[model samples]
Target chain A: MEYIIISTGFALALLGLWGILSQKNLIKIILGFTIFNTGINIVMVSIGYVRGKAAPILDVIKPSEAADKIVDPLPQALVLTAIVIGLGVTALMLVYALNLHREKNSLDINSFKDLKW
Target chain B: MIKKILIIGLLAGVGLIFFDLFNAYQGSEVLGKTGRYYAENGADEVGAANLVTAVIVTYRGLDTLGEVTILFLTAAIISFVLKFRREDFIPNRPVRITSELLDSASQVIVPVIFMVGIYIFINGHLTPGGGFQGGAVIASGVLLMIMANPNFGISHKVIAKVESISGIAFVLIGIMGIFLAGGFLDNRLLGLGNLGELFSAGVIPIIYTFIGLKVGAELSNILGTISHAQNEKN
Candidate 1:
């Protein structure tokens, strides 16, 4: 079931990439990037999950001796870091998008052709 | 098309070679058992049930400090991009609203959302939520207010104070860790009390609180700047 979810996420990510590549709308491209980012985060977190296991934090009320039963905390930390970085990047991108809107008066990627050969 | 195929083939070949090299190093003792050892001993030493937090705040705290610096740099860059330096400015006309009910509903919801963000940040160490999550939530609350009440601009002075104070506090906490625990960002300064407790992780919670506030302010400022810029252009 986990593998299936991950695979579907991957598929959606690929679809997002396709959207980014094919779409002319800047908003669509941004949305596509978000979709891709979400997929990657989900896949990473899923890889760290262990069936029937609680999060790595020791249960103070009910301690367990089985190490294998605890889900790895490393990926969660990494994901948290990734999510913050993603927010920063997205904020920067939105700022740039606003600038683009100012200049071109449209949210179309194709319209941003200043550097095209 | 042919070039794309060639590039894909080359990438696959390189990936395979990389995997092979990784496999060769997997069983090698030369890699050392430092990570495993740390993983085993971390919980007891740092008194943090969250091994990842232990590693981040205790074992490799300097790196985390550097990461926070990077966040600071990003915030600086954003501020530079969105700086409002003009001597004279014209405020945009207020957004026209049709429904009094919607405005009243938003006024009620905004404060509740802000409280939720505070709750998330305060209880970060004990739960799945943390500084970043809470910060973003707070920013979203600010964003909600901005959207619902266009005239209700966040006080620039308040945001500036929050951002600067949080940034300073983060650095001071790191320095305190260094002074109290023989290393920068050391988690042992706060007695390393019983694990799973709210105050157990010492500087982790403190660092995270600063991080949350800073992130929240920076994000909301970014959003505000973008919207303001759009309004000006319009």
Candidate 2:
């Protein structure tokens, strides 16, 4: 199960990288960045997965058995922060894209030659 | 053609690295040292039903503060980048009239969404959701309202006030942690109530509440700024 999730994350990440590299539309590239971000989050969560373990919540499980019964909570916490940060980064990227579009009146990456060598 | 090929080559290399890491990773049968310690002692130490919340709200709380600061900066930077004068504003484009279904449904759904957002953050100590999730949900509610009415003005004054007040409260609680409890941002600043209760984790719920309000305001500010900017065409 963990392997499947981890592999799916990798696949999505690769797909997102392809989108980022090949897409000409600024919005599409931002979409790719978001997909990539989600993929990374998934991979991080899967890394904490323990076989046949419950979630880190102690609602049903006894506190005494929590160490043995639950999956890793640390990664969950780290990924929580990562997810929020990703949202911020994605929002910033979209704002940047909006500004870029306003300046060039085009979403195509090829239209902006100011940074081209 | 060359660019496409180069891109594929780069992706393949990255994929290979991922594959290598994947192959080496044997799913652990047990928690790591830190995770084990938290899992075993977290409930007693934090008195929260959700270990993840215990970890995020208390154990690594300084990181959460940094995360909130980063989000606030992102919103600020977006608004700053998008600042335009009324004199420079282009003529407003034709606003699309939302469908009746959406218009009416949103009126009913938005309040429920807001309530759920509040519930999620309030129950952050016992549930899987937390302040960030709740804030995003609240922002989505704001987004729905904006979508229903393109010209819906979210008062900047209100958003700014909410954000600053919550932010100050968050920091103040953290300061209180130093004086009253262990270190900074300590959830134990307030006495930990009975586990699984609504108010179990001392300052976790309070901090998460503030974090939720601040995040909701920041994100709503970003959404409002961006949506308003849609009217300004060069």
Residue-level lDDT of model 1, residues B1-234, one tens digit each, is 885676566555644653453344321221124434444566667776666566655676666566656666676777677666464344764567837776777788878877887777766656666667788888888887777766666676888898899878877877887777867667677787777888876777877788788878877877676666544524
Q: List the residue pairs that clash in candidate 1.
A: none
Query: How would you encode candidate 1's per-residue C-alpha lDDT over A1-117 as one tens digit per residue?
Result: 555555655656665666566668887888778777887787666666655565666544233342444555666667766766776677677667766776789998878889999
Candidate 2 CAPRI classification by DockQ: high
Give the range where candidate 1 chain B is weakest over 10 consecutive residues by summed lDDT.
B23-32
Off by over 4 Å in 1: A60-66, B1-39, B83-88
Q: Candidate 1 DockQ score?
A: 0.28
Models 1 onward score TM values of 0.83, 0.97
- Please state the error at residue A108 of candidate 2 in Å: 0.5
